[model samples]
Target: MAETQRFHDRVALQLDDDGVAQLRLSRPDKMNAIDAGMFAGLVAAAEALQAMRGLHAVVLHGEGRAFCAGLDMASFGRMSEGGGVANGLNDLLERTHGLANQPQQVAWAWRELQVPVIAAVHGVAFGGGLQIALGADVRYLAADARMSVMEMHWGLVPDMAGIPLMRELLRSDVARELVFSARIVDAEEACRIGLGTRLCADPLAEALALARGVAGRNPDAVRGAKRLLNQAADGDAASLLMAESVEQAKLIGSANQREAVLAVMEKRAARFQD
Candidate 1:
């Protein structure tokens, strides 16, 4: 399906002229919880972003009082009937989307994007909700926002790749304590512990500003930097250096690159294509 202001009835995506996409979880009535439709919406948004040329960044935020409350209550009801979470999720062991299952993709999709995704977290980001926030390249959390590795309390692991994302951000000991205890962390402590990239009075506004700033840069360079950084943790020094060269080689002397240089000299904004 073509892009629209709203899709799947639960998510909205808007890419402005600045090349910054505003991706919102729109099911406010349910605190934007992850339901079957929400899952599809997230995946569809990510897929659309991947196809959108000249996109530089994304600002992901929730549309209601909370970012997301995690899986819908109905999913928990099904688990209470003595079966795994199989509603639209299928088998937990199946890897439906490369290295992740469909459920994991809801969060992993943001991380997998080549461009930067900044999550503007507010209210509460619980369980799978927190995982989705973590999927972003950076998180700007409101001062009063709350987050948790919430699945443990429900007799499940952080199955939405939250643990894996947390491993990248939090200390091993800290992650263990939070996952095991299912403790909720406020924005202040979350920033101190590295779960939040930044804390502010208004996260969505800050995130959008940051995204627009990034969008103002040469998009090719911005994408190259993100692609390189995404592999830094896993790739060896030699491989990463080569990867950096490969990315730079593609960006050097491109039209946007030349425009960036001329724009600096002329003290004007560089025009980029979409």
Candidate 2:
């Protein structure tokens, strides 16, 4: 294990030699609820990860029983007194982080990361927390985990980049109902509805194992695939087809690709440089 970096005392980031990073929301006593500090910490964590060279994969999880409960009561209390004011910020409509505010950045930053991010969810993921999970490329959820789009209960809406992320994973009606009703969903139902990628008895362990496998692969190829996939949804057929060719051409005869083929033929693990 490398030195664990603390962000605002709310998030812990540990990067291992295998090019995998574990980002834990560290406030377990409060179910890892998103408070003002947590909001800032998450953005900081994402920024730090994006800057880390040779980082192939990331596993995101909470330190305690739950992934995240939701926005903390103190934030709600503060909103009531200050009319949506946050950390001396202007308003929610303000773009604080290039097409995202601070709250949205907590979730959106993971989506913009170059490498794959896997969320290992347990206990409850509500509102903003669920958005954070949705930001990941894959989600491994515990059987007992419960999730909800719970902003309705607070007389608010899913403003933390939840709507766009949910639309990519869920049917329009299911997404609408979840947001409008704010009903609790079990892990089984969440997986069935495309909210969760898979179920695991020990979600964090499963996630770490999977991330290690991803990290063991050709790092450039993995990043290229992620880039193409992220652009697939909104890209035109002709553009995406050309993009695939362009990306493939760049990797087909590369050193990493040659090493990958040699390792497979020799029945050995591929040692990737990046």
Candidate 3:
């Protein structure tokens, strides 16, 4: 059996027996905006996911009209007052999750997860919201979705793991343009610029289908593939080749690998154990 957990009423997490996990941003009333509570919820949810057994794939999405509208206005107001916000800003500088602070961990945690993570984005994903989606291995956007690197509009820069994540997905020039102009990009342009992996009529549905397909594969092989792909983003050619060999060596004659081969030969589905 699977259970759903709520974090400060801002994030919801549910795991199915098939090893597919669904993580939803739940603050719909505020367009799922990131506030102090939302930040805490996101980190808590990511930490919980890290310990989940048999986890294979994850789908990240938002409830309500927009995926996320960046930071909450109240938080900005606090910054203007120069009191409450100062403490929060200082806290972001402290390392809480190995190379990332608490806020950065909200996004980087997905990148650190061993299994595949798919982001299903719709409505608008601005600033922090956009950064969160970029952290995922794949992004599925609805045709009508709107996204932007909007920190410039607020006289701020993206600091929540956005820079490193964008480097992995976009060309240097393209990233600079979007970041400089703070322009809103439609789904088609987002796909063309590499911000989105695919565009769909229903992003959540398509993302779930993709996640389920990934979950049905041999878990060890799937994890190895994700690890290799992640390494390819930053590793040298020789190192990547060595990593490929190492991963393949672990998978080639394993029981799950053998089951995969036999199932294909028998024209049946493979029953893989965790």
Candidate 4:
């Protein structure tokens, strides 16, 4: 088991013996609302995870009633104050983490992580909160969970890496409608619209179970698959085909891959090395 760490008092990290890391937004008092501290904490947590060895999968969730309540009201208030909006927008425009700025990095960092990331969402995931969840490889939503493309309601846009992520998940028209209306969608609708992988009574439990399953696989193969899938989102057909060949070549004779084969032939569980 990896020791639990706290990031800026806003996020918590715990890695289990299965090599599944659980990242929780930990400001339950504020419903895990994103603030300056929360934003920094998220980035810090992702950066820390990126450096972790033996990591297999990640489960992201909240410690509060909601996954996240979007930007904190105080942040909105600051935006409305003198020169705040311009300064904020200027800061956001600066490239801090590859193609993403600081705010966008808070979400994009998870996508950039080599391992699979799963979000277990419940209660409300509004605006930036929903965008953060969208950053994950898969989202498991609670039956009663509510989500929205809610930036319009705040006189802002979903700039926290939401645009690119949503484009990948939803139809163009559907995405536009959600952005324009800023309407809250239920879990069923979210699943239909591609925002959710599935609906579960206990999303965190399901996410953990899925993470454990992934962790049980050959880590090299699992990470290779994630790399190929992430590339497929933007890579051309030829590049994707080549990528498959490259990843397969790397895994075919790997010790862990051989162990996987042996385990199946012997009717026992695979003991894969990280």
Candidate 5:
């Protein structure tokens, strides 16, 4: 078990020896909804990952039934319709923090890390919660997982940065229909619609397996590859090609990378520089 009391409010952050840092959404009583405190916890977790060294990968998951049930309706009730409150909300738009990150950016912050971030999603991921899952570079989902573009159902739109991230994952029409209809779909449909990377019986186990595999690789090269991929994912074709070339150039003559090749040939563990 983690040192739970160390965390302030909404989430659990733990780092294990295998270079895998797990960020768990820990509001089991509420299905891990995006409450103000939880948002703060998510941001703190991102910062911790940023400062960590020798970290190979991250696994993001929730503590209970639903990965997240989007925003907590009760929290939204706290804000009054007034100039000061509206201004403060607008300030969040202009500034940046791990917690204040637009719903999408909170998850994207993991992507911005120098290591890989994988999300293990199960249960219900509705509205903003679904968008949070989209923030991960890879998602390992349970076969029966339920997801939704849920904002519409609540008379609101997905303002949590779901639009841009989901754009890459779905067709324009498909994205629109889901958003407009607020349709809830299962993991199988999620995979078909490009919302999932893989569907498994045990998502966390699958995610940890992949994380361990990544941890076993040359950390430097893995970091470089992640950077290049991030650049390519956001850049144009020419830029992507250039990024690939640049990354390969750095990896080719590196000692650790060479050891990787030699280790495989010799069938031994790589004695990396670390």
Candidate 6:
């Protein structure tokens, strides 16, 4: 498998031989803060992921002292000059995407992928950055990672779809407390609060390792498991049961799935679909 690199100059996209794609937020000079370029790059990266064949997993991380310092100061400045913060996002929402819905889709698209997405978070993942991380199927945070629900401090609620994502992860009261308080919490506290999967010594390396492991498994089973799990996370009781049936129905007679069972029986590696 030849690795392909997609360079947008602001976001770095790389796909490895084992089918794990890595997307790095590259505007380190400003702590990789969200700006027009970064947002465009993120959308392009998501589009690339959707088009690529044989994608097994993805790892999203930032290149800087912080995962991201949240929205760029320029955005805030513009918001101040205009109506307000809500007005700023409202403009972005109206102009920046397909019918898929831009702001929510930016993070939600990761969840929409057929494969698993693991976010490797470090330093400060605040506001929008934290919301983006929450979109991933799994998050590996550095033990010293600092995170906050920072929108309230700016006199805004999290409108980048953080509420829905966080709702599934935290209890209602706890989620409310975190969002309202806007206090930064360390990785250990994040884990305790159900915001992170593991407190890694080195999050990026750990995320990649996990991606490789998933890639090496039966891709069909792995993808099916992701579908089932994702549905279970947000699905109602009836849909949860139907989700399993629906996913299993797709796998039952599929060539790759059959090969998966055969390969296991023959003690060999399965050759899967592209």
lDDT of each: 0.79, 0.81, 0.79, 0.81, 0.72, 0.75
lDDT of 2 by residue, 87-154 (tens): 44445555677666777789878878999999999999998899899889999999989999987655
Q: List candidate 6 segments past 4 Å from native.
A: 1-8, 83-100, 235-274
Candidate 1 per-residue lDDT over residues 162-248, each given as its tens digit: 655776799999999998898999999999999999898889999989999998998889888887776774333333223323443
Error of 1 at 38 (Å): 0.6
RMSD list, candidates in order? 17.8, 17.9, 18.0, 17.9, 18.1, 17.6
Q: What value of lDDT does candidate 5 attain over all alpha carbons?
A: 0.72
TM-score of each: 0.83, 0.83, 0.82, 0.83, 0.77, 0.79
In Å, residue 235's CA in model 1 sits off its true spot by 6.2
How close to the true structure is residue 140 of candidate 5, measured as C-alpha lDDT? 87
In model 3, what lDDT does residue 129 have?
A: 94
Worst 10 residues of 3 by lDDT: 237-246
- Tens-place lDDT digits, model 5, residues 1-274: 3343324478787777887888889999999988667766777777777898768898889987879988775533332111121112323333254332334456557657888889999999998788778878898899768999986553345655566567678999999999888889999999998999989989999999999899999998998998887776654433322332334334432555455445544567778797
Model 2 ranges with Cα > 4 A deviation: 86-89, 234-274
Q: How would you encode candidate 4's per-residue C-alpha lDDT over 1-274 as one tens digit per residue?
A: 6788999999999999888999999999999998878988999999999999889999999997999998886655444332243224334445667666777777878888999999999999998899899999999999889999987654455777777777789999999999989999999999999999999989999999999999999999988998888787743433332332334334433455456445544568777798
Q: Which scores greater on lDDT, model 3 or model 4?
A: 4
The residue-level lDDT of candidate 2 at 6 comes to 96
The residue-by-residue lDDT of candidate 3 on 110-190, one tens digit each, is: 888999999999999998899889889999999878999986554456766777778778899999999889999999999
Model 4 segments more than 4 A misplaced: 83-90, 235-274
- The per-candidate count of clashes, in order, stands at 0, 0, 0, 0, 0, 0
